[model samples]
Target: MIQNRSLARRGAAVVAAGAAALVLAACGGDGDSDSSAGHGGHKATASASASSSASASASQGQRNAADVAFAQGMIPHHRQAVEMAGLASGRAQSAEVSKLAADIRKAQDPEIKTLSGWLTSWGEDVPAKGAMDHSAHDMGGMMTDGEMTELENASGKAFDTAFMKLMIKHHEGAVEMAKTEQADGAYGPATRMAGEIITSQSAEIEQMNKLLGKD
Candidate 1:
């Protein structure tokens, strides 16, 4: 009887030891699975962040190209118009014509300054101080030195008539140039200015035509 009881107690202790070992093995497997899951989550987050940063960089590069072209083209165009406006101030005879020239000079000079600043900020060159090749015939409403001299020498109604005629043609040419930029230019600000020029100059051209009829 005593031997049988000792045997039963030893059997119970062996079973308990086996159960404990099984429990420890299960805990170790669960810990490994959790660690692997954490590593995978970290990798996914890193990949997402890298993709987002690349997209932002590409968008900014596109905007930069547009801004640069707008500043470069518009500066030269505005400069020529301002030169023409200056001629009008001294040569125009009618009070209305003189007022129009003054307004054009005032509006365009400040715009020139603004465009110059944009070019500087973009690290682009401002248009140099020379006449651009603006004509296929060398007479696309562009006043040569001789033509300007002729206008400058005239007085009274003749001056007014000549100035209005020249300016009407000049504005037409500017409108054409602005249309080109609006169609093909890349930057938002530049394209917008080009549209404005087309609208305003077209209206002025009509006014100048009326002035022509008066004479």
Candidate 2:
């Protein structure tokens, strides 16, 4: 009878060991499932974060019609300013006026390229490079062919005076366009350019007035 009781106890121990092994296996599977689920969740979150970032970047640089117009109009306008500046050295008498012309050329030339680049990137039309006829466009500060011709014909102090008068008007026109962009343009870079034009050219206008002895 003692031997039979010993056998029964052994059988019970075997059953208990098997049950414990099964429980451990089940727990291990649960752990693996939880780990896999956590990894999947992380991947999903990363994908969502990446998508949101791309969306934000695209939206921030988006342009409107006003922005397009501002860029397009400014390109030719800046070109004209650069052209006018080029004419100053041979004709202008005032050292200050000559320096101012050089400065205007240096500043607006790069800005013209920048504005053109913006339009190209936006899939918009870049203004044609040439003697742009401003008659058709409502851009402010545009010099007529006659005005430019007249200025070109002048010499010495006469040229300096004409340059100052024309440039002041040109700067005023740029200011008007810039203010319009500041109010209505949607592209961040273009609008900022507009504001810079207003600030810088307005100061230049004041300087031109001084050059003209009007300030």
lDDT of each: 0.72, 0.88
Residues 20-66 of candidate 1: C-alpha lDDT, one tens digit per residue: 99999999989999989999899999999999997775544334554
- Which candidate number has the best lDDT? 2
List the candidates' TM-scores in order.
Answer: 0.64, 0.83
RMSD of 2: 2.9
Give each prediction's root-mean-square deviation over alpha carbons. 5.3, 2.9
TM-score of 1: 0.64
Candidate 1's C-alpha lDDT? 0.72
> Model 2, poorest ten-residue lDDT window?
130-139
Q: Model 2, residue 138: displacement in angstroms?
A: 2.4
Best by TM-score: 2
Report the Cα lDDT for residue 23, model 2. 100
